[model samples]
Target: MTVQEQYPARYYARYDHAATQPAPVTGWYDVWGMSDASSVPDAADLVALSAAQWSARTPTGLGVQNGQIVSYAPPAPTLAAQARSALVQAQAATWAKFGSLGKTVTDDWITYQQALSAIADGSNATATDLPSAPSS
Candidate 1:
């Protein structure tokens, strides 16, 4: 079935009118007309229709479905990501050295360097344990 076919008639009608309009109509009322106010589709119906249409038009896995975003989580970090993460951790550790916790920061910096070395050797164990930066 076509994407528009997936939604209710009111939605398809409103979408059809909007898609074809060269200039903005004041509202769906203006497009569908106001001969009988009782026949007007509720705003919510139109909204739902628009959302469904938008999702259908979006490439297969790229948009929201049933109110939740469709997203793919990467299974693992790439080598470049590992390297960048290690650099960020190292920088955080360096900055921490300026605080009162110099020794702890030094330890974390060492750990980050080890992780960076491991990443270079195609190992992810150490990188996985790299500490996050201190808040504030």
Candidate 2:
């Protein structure tokens, strides 16, 4: 079944319109209007639709809608995706099992990287030691 068929837009549109007053039409014609316009543009719902449509049709795993092209998460293969999923799960589990320890580890890692970057760029060198090392 089509995505739209499986999860009908009409159902949501009807539910959205139910609380509002009927629109005025040239007597014989009746128009249904949404009760809350702001509620129609739900971010999560849009994202879910985008994900489904893109996964099925788009080569780049991305799509353009309403004049903008958006980057989408690529659909994964059974093996690589499973491995990545496992890695993410394990990382999350590690963080949960050692919350403060994880933070400490991350903090130390960041500090070490900063120091290494500084040394690599010669930022740790003093002006007095500049003459000892020949200028480039």
Candidate 3:
């Protein structure tokens, strides 16, 4: 099976507090059985945390310092970044629904798809005035 490379926005890792020497990795857990991972410092048995034994765990990017959870100051995404991301999402949804419509695809949708692809490409990647998506 292929490995998942991209991590969620609020990813977390868990390691033994007192064992394994040091394995405190931040983002995606990179340390594994000496083959798929590089050794981490300050933690051991590094594993990605999802949920607790009871309810589903929330993705909060929780951190530990000394022993208490702490907040991290990740940079906020820019407006252009948000716009470009929306463009990508629009492209994916439109293509999935309309791409296989074949002859049934309308001219408007075709134009919309092209515009989305274009913005997602070229140097000008961000746009505030994106074309409206075709009705569901």
Candidate 4:
């Protein structure tokens, strides 16, 4: 069994306030295992955040199109799909950065499946229930 399955978010949160070891304080626990109601950032939240950060930047080198499309042309069917994929890419990086961090990458990949399920639903767009944002 994987570490995350053995030590789910609740395990970390329960011991976060008292655990004296590094196991409960670093890595995923710090981000995906927060004390908040949701363990991770929703897809919508990440998308909006990424968009905001992207918007704040000034693109250089590329000549301005003026009246043409000047944004990153997404290859996904919906905004949710694009956002979800972006989240996956970030998660993969996180998995690679922290000694695999209790198999954090595997766990996030599983969670990504769930995010896709949520996004596929015909509900109103919101970031309230998306999975955690992966690393940069």
Query: How many clashes does each candidate structure show, in the order listed?
Result: 0, 0, 6, 2
lDDT of each: 0.44, 0.35, 0.49, 0.40
Better of 3 and 4 by lDDT: 3
Better of 3 and 4 by TM-score: 3
Identify the candidate with maximal lDDT. Answer: 3
* Candidate 2: residue pairs that collide: none
Best by TM-score: 3
Candidate 3: pairs in clash: 22-41, 22-42, 22-43, 23-42, 23-43, 24-43
lDDT of 2 by residue, 1-136 (tens): 3333334332221112222223111111001123344434433233233344333443433433332334445343444333344445544554654564644435443344344344435565432221111111
lDDT (10s digit) by residue, model 1, range 20-72: 22322222333222334455555443434344644354322232233323332
lDDT-superior candidate, 2 or 4 = 4
Candidate 3 Cα misplacement greater than 4 A, ranges:
1-38, 42-59, 63-70, 73-102, 123-126
Q: lDDT score, residue 12, model 1? A: 23
* TM-scores, each model vs. reference: 0.30, 0.20, 0.37, 0.23
Off by over 4 Å in 1: 1-51, 55-75, 98-108, 120-136
Q: For candidate 3, write residues 59-124 as lDDT tens digits.
A: 554444444334534456654555468667766676677675653556777776677556656545
Minimal lDDT window, size 10, model 4 = 61-70
lDDT of 3 at 33: 22
lDDT of 2: 0.35
Candidate 1 or 2, higher TM-score? 1
Model 1 scores worst on lDDT over the 10 consecutive residues at 20-29
